[model samples]
Target: MEKKVIGRRERITLPEWGLKMVTAKVDTGAYTSSIHCTYTEEREVDGVMTLFYRVLSPDNKKYKDKIIATSNYTQKKVKNSFGQAEVRYKVSTKVIMFEEEFDAEFTLTDRSKMRNAILIGRKMIQGKFLVDVAEVNLSLKSKK
Candidate 1:
């Protein structure tokens, strides 16, 4: 089946994560997309650090309905906007937008204070889109 294309900036829904109508910034400069999370806890389950946390939006609303995840490994020394490095947990999941699905990495961090909850980076959108900076929500608005 052919995949539906998306733009640089679009509103997406994470049905499995119970996140609806969240805006994401499509950044080609970044390799992985990061999501805003809080109350992160790492517990050993079957010799693996099972991650559980709550994702928060800029409005301080918690997506408490969907607050569970597990990953194979955790990456240390990840660089932040200030060029300083910090450890972060990477979780793999399927992101659905515009009727298209793709495997994407979601790095957990507290971005509740930031403007956006998700950053749809290049890795998730590689070969799947053509970003037009002047445009926003092309997929959502087109349906209307």
Candidate 2:
């Protein structure tokens, strides 16, 4: 398959979460992708263990404090910016970029301090995309 060229920064859509055009940083240095989560908790619902979480910030007009639950999740030990290993919940979800949908894995973390809510790491784009630092929002511009 031909690899698509993605900009250093681009707007992405998380259709399953009802999130659209969320700005994401394409970081080839990082090994795995991550999505910002203000809150996260695990609860036992009926006979199954369910994970409940909220995406983005409550200040955002569109997706504010909406509780999203999923049972398909696992814990992964990922290194933080400080190079410290931290255990975070890893969830498989669909991410739309360059008008193409792909199954991507994202680690849930608090990125309220970061500029972008989503971080597109190497794993998500491995063998699938090439990052070009010279451009930004290439996907959005293609739609125009």
Candidate 3:
């Protein structure tokens, strides 16, 4: 299989959450992908424990103020930038990049201080893409 080339940074979409053109940084050093979440909570919905979370802040006019709820989530111990172990919520969502759709798992975390809201890790790009550090937005450019 020929792997597509992606840049160090690319635009992606989460169709299930109504998000488009979200900037995501490629981090080959990390194992699991992560997304910035405003907040996350566990509540009983329709008699089932559900995980609800919101992504991006209201300032991001294009996609904001939306809550995504699902029982299909898990918690895992992930290392932070400081290399400290922290348990974070992980969920699967449909990610669209370079016009290709695929299911990818993203860990929910408070990345308000980070430059980009999304971080695409090795796991998500492993078998599908090759990263070019000097390039950026290769996915979006491919459409032009």
* Per-residue accuracy of model 2 over 29-121 as CA lDDT, tens digit each: 899999889899999999899999998888997888688899999999999877999999999889999888999999999998888889999
> Looking at model 3, how many pairs of residues clash?
0
Q: Candidate 1: lDDT over CA atoms? A: 0.74
Weakest ten-residue segment in model 1 by summed lDDT = 57-66
Predict model 2's lDDT versus the native. Answer: 0.91
> Per-residue lDDT for 1-144 in model 3, tens only?
789999999999999999888889999999999998988999988899899999887578765768899999999999998899999999999999988999999999988888988999999998999999999999878888
Candidate 1 C-alpha lDDT tens digits along 1-144: 444556667988776676667889887787778988766888888887688777765345465555676655466456765678888888777677876666777788777666777888777877777678878898897688
Q: Rank the candidates by TM-score, best first.
A: 2, 3, 1
For each of the candidates, give the backbone clash count. Answer: 0, 0, 0
Q: State residue 13's C-alpha deviation in candidate 3, in Å.
A: 0.8
Candidate 2, superposed: residue stretches over 4 Å from native: none
